[model samples]
Target: MSVRSGDKKTKILNPITIEKDFGGPIGAAFLTIFLPLTTIFLHLCCNEKYLAQGLSLEFNKVKDLFYDEVIVNFKENFFNERIWLVYCSWFFILVFLDFILPGKHLKGVELRDGTKLSYKINGLAMMGLLASTLIARFIQTNGEMPELSFIYDNILSLLCTSIFFSILLSCFVYICSYLPLMMSKNGINTNERILAAGGNSGNVIFDWFMGRELNPRILTWDIKLYCELRPGMLLWLLINISCLHKHYIETGGKLNQSLLLVNLLQGFYIVDGVLNEEGCLSMIDITTDGFGFMLAFGDLTWVPFTYSLQSRYLVLNPIQIGWLNFSLIILLNILGYYVFHSSNSQKANFRKDPASFNQMKSIKTKTGTLLLCDGWWKLSQHINYFGDWIMSWSWCLPTGFNTPLTYFYVIYFGFLLLHRQKRDEDKCRKKYGESWKEYERKVPYKIIPYIY
Candidate 1:
């Protein structure tokens, strides 16, 4: 009998099968090598002086069978460079394994399967992120302790300092990683164009990680459902604290002023991105980074270590010093929240029923004939961006400007929106042709009123 099975039989394999099978072994080897090497480096750098000082602190037991001091130590140590390195070492190794191993071919799953697929791991990028994280950690640990030199027990200065660094560090981490990905030749742009051209529209994790054994779409839905149930407001608050506040305390800490007033304002932009939903959805993963970076490293490193688990340490502690600023800060938060939430809601409502809320009219102007009228969109072509800037200012206000670093979020976001708006305009002009010309004539402004 002629064996027809060899030519006809098809094999289906999950993308993760190889990683799942080999991940543990690879991960184990990495930790075994990385941990010891890191410890040796620390030992060499710190020598007996630091070690002796570290060891001298005795653990005083308390309630919860874990002493408060011990708990504090755990929190602080979690943010330390050593712990971060150890954790990253494991993931780094897994990425390394992906690089080395021959990617398997399967009958059912292929990059051309109309689905976006990333068969190889982003080892180089991951390594760069790990390095940047290390640098941030090193600066925090080695940098001069935040001196309360400006005022004799001035609490506001301290709080401002904390907010400044926290925001700065967060921005640093974000920009270092995101800029490369966005600008890379074989990056999100390629994926976006690919998806637009009738290819598979699966989530980014599947495409970036080559883990096709699991349906990434289902996983993404599950994550969204879970996020929806809990709502990330609290998580955002928590994670933001851990990540950003460290620099504040290390450089020159202050009060627990509500940067949320600012974040609330920033939220308007964030929500706008969310409403856009296409680019924004990918942002969460990009920001949080597989929980490996955020949960394992972020919570321990930034939250407890830098800020010492007291978000309000700088803002609340020195009531007398920050009194005037605190009052102003509160007002800013309120304004930010009002503008942010109101503008977003207005946009959402307008989008829901454009005819009812907004009146469409064609107008002749100096530029040309364009669509003009009244409503949210007509109020200003991109009022949401204005609200976004206001919110960013409010958040940065709390930092009180020891350095301009804290304003990075607002500045970066503004630039991002402007670029995006320009890009969208170009696309609209190309797609809508004369309709866009007429619309531009009607609108007359890009982002702000009587300004641009």
Candidate 2:
């Protein structure tokens, strides 16, 4: 087939054509080695143990009968657990709907530019996993919290087993999700091709502002490892911190300080992360990877990172509140969001339409105007790093000044950006060589303007 640009009819391969078989034992081997190794590394650093009991319980089927009851207990303990469950349920439903329903896959359909998910298939896959999870939970627990037995006796072990199976199930369903697209095209596979899907389906306001252009696929770093590691790492850290905080609170009874501000900020950060799936996928690391990579990163890394910390911490004790200071907390939280969101928006827009920029200003230096500096870019070639730092700082606000330890994320991010900037600079120097030299002549500082 052919597509027209001007006078030329460009030969276009079927967008869904799978001419080569990339998924095989080799790919599966690669995924297994990558996920578990990274998880183990994180476990070691966090001082977390993959309890043998937990590993054993993960496979026991007797645990499946008591899952619903356990979740009920979970709700009694967590308060808002029911609402959370409902929300999760809805999400799985939506993903499944997109997978099964015609025109919902976000591939080939051209009414909008949303990223594809098999709503129909995703739903079935998720439901199957959820059912299996419940069954595993029930059979393992059997409506009783027996005294801590061993891997064969613990809920956590059962959960681990459930997640292992769930991951396998999700991958199976995900593969099946693509089969329809494949069969429709007579066994053609087209994962790499850019095919328009869901025409003009975005929100009216968003459509006007952003248009239907797909996000650019650019690789500034090898962030696949980072993405895979980040979620699991985050979860584990949260669990450890929770454990620490619980110990502190239990020992001291109640304190004279409040943490409302910090908790709110953390909530916002998490919600924002979920809402920006497209932006997340826009990152070069995700686009460069195939389905196997996605499964490894999303399941092993992200899921564990986000959950482990809170689970560990909450089990230890409760978050105590002291004095409430609402005003200052709100303002700082807002400032943090402004910095983080604004900088990201600027970069996205700039990449889409660099010519939309009105001014072509340059900074003057001993070497002449050179190539660096001007506007926000002049303030910091990597303004987004500053924004990210601010957000991380705000999220840690709830912890207060008891210890600088709570602010680990911000500190870690600062170091990360510095390293990334240096790497980027080195790459630029190599790629552009002399031109990069000229650009740097105009802008000297790395992150903070005039300060760093």
Candidate 3:
């Protein structure tokens, strides 16, 4: 519903939450559009050329640099057939596969209305299908595959396209929620609209950013699930593979150790995500948050386009990682994935049925859910977040002592998880009251081990 600040001073992310009330409601609305657009613009601005130009500019020269690059070169990269085709094809393929594939039907947690939404789980199958399709294409072409180079060549074009799609989808979903009754035939009219826990504070900017509704559905389609797991996650892997292919071509078809290590670790991470697809249903983003601009932009644009930066960086500038470092990196990734996956599975399994893991001990509270103060949960209140931090760093380290640009995910993700952990703790406190305090006392650390 809303991100947690330091304490329980929960501010609804509306227009009034702005630092200055220059234009009032208009200011809030402007911010809702301005912030995300600026981030996207800056990301485009930080392209290889722009960054180089930035370093070479003086006070007055900066304006000239911006005019030439931002206004001139940016427009050139913003539009390309390769970018458009790849972006469109990627979206179409993922959605179509999700539609036609067979999956196991499962029920989510019961909502306040006493009904559980059913979801079809088939992400792992989809991954296999994608890999097989690519392999088939490679084989049919007699070991030659050129399509993968498109992403490397048209990174900016793809980025602009992704931003366009994100804005389009966010607006479409907002409209769907805004006029659901009118949009929904048979006049299944309702007086009150369903809003998320901390959303719908009557601030247009805040509501637009945070989203107003929880579990928005169109017939059997759950919009949140579709965005959260299906498209962008796979798209991220596809981008990495493209980077790998392009690197291979440039490096005389010989992939270096650093790039290979990054590719392998990320591939494992994605495979883990796909294999444990059901676990995602229990996460906060799925059961709690609404489908809004924040999530829409994040899932559609930021994830696929930005998250694979390390691999993208390594494509043009190949870094040689020694075998020792490669092995160490692999071990670190495995450790992180092991802890992250185990903690998530333990908690999910505990919630599904406490007896699922016989060795796993938990404290059963009065409200009925068990507090897992054993195993990974004993290490920290949010041990999985620590694991995520470890893996994010591992993903970046392969780039070596390079520009700070490659390490952006590590910095950004750390803050994200910090806020997420605090938010989850706040949610638990509200849900379980005194019992949550007891659980916190039992597991003192928030994220890291003993130190934090």
Best by lDDT: 3
- The sequence of per-residue lDDT tens digits that candidate 3 reaches over residues 1-452 is 22223354643321122222225456546755675554454354345654422123455655654466446766565665666677778777777777778888888876543347788888878878988989998889755576666556666667667766776776676666565333322222232234565445566566566666767776666778888876778778878888788767666779888878888988888777886788778888887776777788788777877687778667657788899999898888888887887888777777667776657666677788789888888999899898889999899899887477677789889999988887787778878988888888888899999977
lDDT of 1 by residue, 130-190 (tens): 3465468658866332221211122222222323333333334322322222222223232
Off by over 4 Å in 2: 1-94, 97-263, 289-295, 298-300, 303-330, 360-373, 400-408, 411-434, 450-452
- Where is model 1 poorest over a 10-residue stretch in terms of lDDT? 192-201
- TM-score for candidate 1: 0.41
- RMSD (Cα, Å) for all candidates, in order, is 17.9, 13.7, 6.0
Question: On residues 217-242, what C-alpha lDDT tens digit does candidate 2 reach at each position?
Answer: 12211122223323333333333334
Worst 10 residues of 3 by lDDT: 13-22
Q: Which runs of model 3 end up more than 4 angstroms from their true locations?
A: 1-70, 73-86, 142-144, 180-193, 355-361
> Can you give the TM-score per candidate against the true fold?
0.41, 0.47, 0.84
Better of 1 and 3 by lDDT: 3
Error of 3 at 417 (Å): 0.8
Looking at candidate 2, the ten consecutive residues that score lowest on lDDT are 208-217
Candidate ordering by lDDT (highest first): 3, 2, 1
